[model samples]
Target chain A: MANSVTAAKATRGINKTIIYIVCIGLAVLSILPFWIMFVNATRSTAEIQSGLSLLPSTHLKTNWDVLTSKSFDPLKGFLNSFIISASSTALSVYFSALTAYGLVVYNWKWRQAFFTFILCVMLIPTQASAIGFYKFMYQLHLNNSFLPLILPAIAAPAMVFFMRQYLLSTLSLEIVEASRIDGSGEFATFNRIILPLMTPALATQAIFAFVASWNNLFMPLILLTDKSKYTLPIMVSLLRGDIYKTEFGSIYMGLALTALPLFVIYFLLSRYIIAGVALGGVKE
Target chain B: MRRKGTINYAKYGYIFSIPFVLVFLVFALYPTLYTAFIGFTDMKGVIPKPVHILDNPFQNFKELIFDNASFRQSLSNTFILWITNFIPQIALALLLTAWFTNQRLNIKGQGMFKVLLYMPNIITASTIAVLFSTLFAFPMGPVNSLFDALGWSDAPIQFLQQKNTARGIVSFIQFWMWYGNTMIILIAGVMGINPALFEAAAIDGASGFQTFFRVTLPSLRTIMLFTLITSMVGGLQMFDIPQLFITPAGGPDNATLTTSVFIYGQAFKGAYMYNKAAAASMIMFVIAAALAALMFYLMRDRSEGQLRKKLRAQKKAAKAAARGM
Candidate 1:
């Protein structure tokens, strides 16, 4: 019995070691591409073409200069992306919360029906309406404008669904009643009392919305034809197509720049993002 | 005083709901209907023109379904790519989730591992696509140079030029980017299972594998179904990577031409066939709606419905017995 127990313990240790090795191996694989991209960004086109180096080189300044001199402007792209993502995220989160609050608070007729309608809306993929939306925007003279891109976010059904689910579990009616009793207007109560209560959900949804909007290539690619108004993804895409001007270092630099903000955001709020995904899965 | 006390506050709900409702009507609902309408009309070009309803209402749809080789190839390619990526993705995700969630293994630094794994997903897909394209650049790329140095090949491989390899790389990228996300969701599902179930399985002399199969997998049915349907829906809309990975878009021979890419090409690219694109979009929308409906049907509480049926039957039987007595 004693011999068998020792053998079992030894086997257990072996299994744990194997598991750790596999986990670490995958983690490395996950990060290897990004590492190569960053490393390549620092090396010149010739060095990058010659071979792969795991180490960062001294050509970062040169690459940045090369990148800036090209039609692809990282700073402008970043500014454009920031403007779109920030405005859309703000609209998506705030309005979603308000809509969810509306669904939850008042014992109104058509509440359940409206919630179901929103849920149905969630099932429709955005790509399905791309052509018509493009045409409609063109007809309205809203194409090439940020208003069409940002305004549609106000009706983000998935965000509304998430917010509604969050409110259903966390919101208490007594607070709304209390605010009402104290003569606070409905909108004021929502802005003051309710928005604070939804800070956690709002933050999680805001991050998701921001990332999504930032990474959105389809709409902007179709809508914005002007080079000056191009977002980061579009700039990266432009770099891909410019084979004659293939400065590998500068191109990699552009890709890295496009991904840098996301990396920073992910690193800072990974805990919340992961938790949000997990929660989203469970709720689904 | 009674009237003041009886003030109806329901209007507040409508007031708050108006913004969302109006936005949805203008943006979501109207666009969808307009797309459907466009599918039936002959609207094409960069400049706006009066759209004429097709003589046969199904002219674009019939032509696309029957005649258009490119659209059909795109449809098949989309499925092929999605399946190739999804199979490996779910397999790796399940394996990782099993390892991570195993109580016996009790993996350390799971948080750090998860963070690293999910890192790729947060980056822009366009950037990721371009990064991979550069990494696998022909003749003098890092991949080619590495192969040359290692004596793996006599000549540099034209990765993007070849159809199969290009599709494979695209599939690999998709798998790499998403497997971690799937694993995270699966881990959450596993965590949600009651510990008592595992304890009971252990008491029954079940091994770790047996416990996972019996307790974990059984309990994860709902979440797994959710994952599967959502992944399917998302897969149907796959666009960015395939679009930006190669020049002239859609890689060599259009091997990576997804349905979305096809739609994009129709409306935005050569010839600007807005009506045809709308028709394709409508088809995709219909398929997606069907899948969602199927998911809802599968996810319904069948056991509860059965239990209610049984209760009603029992009530009828009890009443009949009383009447007989």
Candidate 2:
């Protein structure tokens, strides 16, 4: 019996060691490209061309100079992306939560139908609507404006679905009942009372919506015409285009700068993000 | 059971959902319907022009699917990239899921590894594309230099300039970016499985691999289906990485051009044919819908099987009763 127990323990040790090695190896592979990107951002064009390394260099300022001197305009791109994504996220999160709450709390006639409609809409790929959307925006004289980027957030079916799932799991109608008893307006109850209760869900959706909108390339690429109005992704694409010389150091700097904000945001709210994914997976 | 002074809450539902309803009408539904209509018409440029329903309503589709080699190439490239990435991606995700959820393993730093792994997914595709293009840049790039130093080749190869290499790199990047997300979802799936089942498997003297195949995978069927369908849909719409990696024309002889990129080019690029783009978009929609339906059918619950068996038994009993009568 003792020998059998010892063998079991030996197998456990082997399994644990194997798991550790795999986990650590994958973690390294995951972060290697980001490390290379940051490292290359500090090197000169020639140095970057020379070879790859695990060390940093002293030419970050030179890269910054080259990046700013080029027509890429990283600062403007950052500002444009920030404005578009922030407004879009705010619109999507608040409105989606409201919609989810509305569907959950009220015993309206069309509630189930509306929910099913949103689910069906979720299945229709947005790429199918690109042609008419482009033409419609042009006719509306909204081309080159941020309205096209910001306004569509109101119809984010995925966020609506997720928020609805979150609400169904966590929210209690008794609070809405109590708030109504206190003579509070419906919108006021939603804004003042229910919104505070939904902080975790809202934050999760906010991060996701922000990242999605910030990384959006297709819509903005078609809508915006002015270089001054370009988002970070659009500008980065242009930099990588073959029309320009697009210096290696400058491109890396542009990429690093663009990704840094995402990394910071992700690291800050990673727990919520991870939990959100779990929530989504389990509910689905 | 009527309350004393509760106000009617049903009205507020309409009020709260007004923004969403309006947005959907103006943006989502209308555009889709309009695109379908425009697919049948020959409208070019940005303006509203006269579109006659000429002899061939299906002309745009026929020209696109049959005559347009670029469209066909894009379709094939998309499938090739998605399948290549998906095979290894699902494998790695399954391995990671199995390892992370193994109770006996008791792996350390699982949270840190998860955070690091999922980091690539959160970064913008454009940024990743730019970073990778530089890494694979001609002659002077790090990959080529490393290959030369390792004596794999004396001369530096322009990785992006070769068709097969470009497609392979793009596929690899897609795999690298998505495998983490897939692993997390699978871990959630494994976690959802009953602990009693694992204990039962252990008591039966089943090995880890045996337990995984016999118990874990069967329980995870629904979640696996969910992941597969989602990944398939996302893969079909892949645009940003391929768009930025290759030139607008899907360069190296249009090897990396996805359908979405092709549609974008047709709509917005030099010639600007909105009609053709709409037709292509409609084709993509059909393909995506058909694929999703097939996956759903394939992964449907076995209640149908039970229903069929029940019906067969009922029919046999009825026949036996008739014969006895």
Candidate 3:
């Protein structure tokens, strides 16, 4: 009995070892694309086409020069993206939170009906609205300005839904009742008391709004005619092949420039991000 | 608790949400409605209902269905794009979720890893297009290189050049971008499961597969269905990636031209013909509404006793396994 048990235990150990190997293998597989992108940034285009560059190369400066080419103006594009994203975020958070507060704290006869209407709108994909958006902007001559890119992003249906759930979960009726009894105006109490209390939720919503606005390539692509008004993603794609994709250092720099701010903001406010996601789930 | 009074907050709340609703109405609902109204007309460039869009407004739709050669090919391409992208997305996501959820595998740093995987989603429009355009290149791209290295074939594959191939490659990039998000949601569902149920199953000597089937899956039925439904709805409206490639006056022979992209081309670039474009948008809206209804039906069980029946099945399956059936 002892001999048989020993053999079974030994086999279990071997099986676990194999599982560990496979897990790490899959993990590496998951990150391989990122690594390839980073490494390829360093090598020459010739090297990349001939074969995969498993190792990172040292042609960093050359890639940088090409990335900052006169036509692309990567920095200017980044700044433009920042300006558009910032304005959009400020608008989205304030309005979405206000809308949520208005709905939850105050009541109306058609409240349920209107709220359902918004929920239905959320199901309509961005593509479904692309034509009207383009034409509407054109009619107003807003196509040239950054407002076309920034304005629509502010009124995200998902953000309103998220804010509503947050208000429902966190805000207490008693507190609102007291504020009202103490003679604070509805909007006044919201601005003074509720907004102050809802800092964390606002911060994360701002992060999402910011990222959405920043990474929005399509609106800018279609609306902005001049090269000077482009965002980073559009700038990167418009990056001609004369520059090259293989030069590792410059491409990584571009990736970092575009993605890092988002990563930092998300990581810093990750707690709120998770909470916001969980907030939606709680409703279900 | 006393009932509260209605405060007529629509005046305030409606004002707050007006921007979104207005945008939706003006650009979305109006254009979609207008396009459908125009589909029957011969509207095109700056013309009333019957003017020309860059090409012909009704011609494309009419030709899509009735014209001899164009009808079959266009419909075939449409189905090809919808399916080639649609099917693999769900399949990969399910498999990846199952893989990641295997607790015995003991994935290290799962949270950080998941967040990293989800990075692609933040890259909404332009970035995804650039990333894929670069990745799916002919001879030089890494994907073809990998296929070659694996001895799948000797020569470089022109994935985006051929009609069917372009659809699949586009779908693959989209699949990579989407599956991570789906997995994150599924992981959330997995995390929400009552651990005690899992422990109880372990105590009964159930294998990993059995425990997953009997406990994890049944509990996740709703969330899983939600994932499936949303993916399908989202798949139908795919436009950005195709549109990005639709530039320089050429794009893969319009093989990758999605319904949304095709509609946009009709209205804006094709001829600024909103009415015919309106028709296409209406078709999409109807499809989306139908799918949503289908989703709701799938999510809700037919009756209250269905839950009891599911539990009974679990018990029966467990007993049968114990009896070595």
Candidate 4:
């Protein structure tokens, strides 16, 4: 019996070592590109052209100077991206949660129909409506403006779907009943009582919405024509495109700059992101 | 339990729903309807002409379907890239899911591994495209340098210049970016499965592989279907990586040009053919919708399947009785 137990332990030890080796090796592969990007950001164009390295070089300041010399307005790009992503995320999460709240709390006549409608819209990919959407924005004279980019978040069908699933799992109608009994107004109950309760869900969706909006290239590429209104991706694309003689170092710096905040956000809120993925799967 | 003056808040539902409803009507429904309407017209200018049904009804589609080599090429390219990326992505995801969720293994720092894997997804696709291009550029690229060190090639491969190589790199990058997300979703599906079923299988002396195939895979059908459909939709509209990879014209001979890129090219680039873009967008929508419907048909529930069987039996029985057989 003791021999068998020892043999079992030995097998488990081997299994554990194998798992660790695979996991760490894969993790290295995952982060290697980003690591190269950061290292290249600190290197000169000549050094980068020579080959890739894991080492940081002494030309970081020079790279920044090159970026500025080339008239790459990273500060403005950052601000524009921040404004668009923040407002869009806030609008998407709040309105989606509100819509989900409405559907859950009320036994209204058209509630089921409205929910089904939202689900149907969820299946219609945004690409399907791009042509008319562009034309519609043109008609409204909203091109080159942030309104078309930001305001459309109010009707994010996927966010609404996610929020609805979250609300179903966490929200209790009795709380609404209790709050109403205590003379809290409907909006007051939602604002004061419910929003706090939905913090975890809100945080997950907010991060997702923020990331999506920040990384979005398609709509902004189509809409914004003014150089000053360009978001980070647009700026990155313009810089990366050998529109002029390519400055490889400067381009890498720009990419590293764009990704830095996202990296920080991910490290801080990764748990919520993992939870959010589970929530996404709950739909099925 | 109905009480008077205790707050009839049902009316506030309308108030809450109004914002979403307005945005949907103006942005979502209107644009889709307009796209459908514009597909049948010859509105080719920056400002749309009043679309009349009788005015060159099939002109845009004729151009998109038959006359345009680039559009046809892009259609095939989108499928090729999606399938190439997705096959490896789903396979890797399944492997990771199986390992990560193995109850016996009890993998340490599972969350850290997941975050690291999913890191590529959060980065801007444009940045990634640029980064990869630079990393794998001809002659002096890191990949080529490594190949030389290993004596693997006579010369550096022009990764983004050649058609097949460009497509391959695009597919690899796409697979690298998305497999993490797919793994997370699949892990969730695995976790949602009843532990008791796994326990029962173990009690019956079934091996891990046997339990996975018999208990886990079948149970994950719905989740797999959901992932497949969403991936198909996203894959069909793939634009950013391919468009940003080299140029908006798509890499060398338009090998990496996705359908959405084609639509963007038509709408925004040289001559700005809005009518042709509308038609292409509509065609893409049909393909996406049909794929979704096919998934739904194939993945219907067993309970629903049984219900249909019973209904068919009852119908046949009723027909036989009516015929006095």
In lDDT terms, which candidate is top?
Answer: 1
Estimate, for each residue in B113-203, the C-alpha lDDT of model 2 and write its tens digit: 8898888999999899878887887878878877977889888888888899999999999999999888888898898888999999999
Q: What is the TM-score of each candidate against the true structure?
A: 0.95, 0.92, 0.80, 0.92
Ranking by DockQ: 1, 2, 4, 3
True contacts kept of 1: 0.85
> Residue B224 of model 3: what lDDT?
73
Model 2 lDDT, residue A15, Cα: 72
Q: 1 or 3, which is superior by TM-score?
A: 1
lDDT: worst 10-residue window of model 3 chain B: B67-76
RMSD to the true structure for each prediction, in A, is 4.7, 6.5, 9.3, 6.0
Alpha carbon lDDT at B88, candidate 4: 91
Instruction: Give the per-residue Cα lDDT of candidate 1 at B283.
Output: 98
Residue pair clashes in candidate 1: none
Candidate No. with top TM-score: 1
Model 1: how far residue B82 lies from native, Å: 0.6
For candidate 3 chain A, the 10 contiguous residues with the lowest summed lDDT are A274-283
Error of model 3, residue A160, in angstroms? 1.7
The residue-by-residue lDDT of candidate 3 on B1-325, one tens digit each, is 1226534444766565567677656656675554454555555575334244445545645654475342244335555666675576656555555656777646556666566556566554555565556666667678788888889978888876786677666666676666557666776777788889988998999887788778878887888777766776777766667665434312577677667666666666745756545556666777788878787556544542574487569768978987784
Rank all candidate structures by their lDDT, best first, as comma-separated numbers. 1, 2, 4, 3
Clashing pairs in model 4? Answer: none
Off by over 4 Å in 1: B1-4, B301-325
lDDT score of model 4?
A: 0.85
Highest DockQ: which candidate?
1
Return the lDDT, model 3, position B50: 28
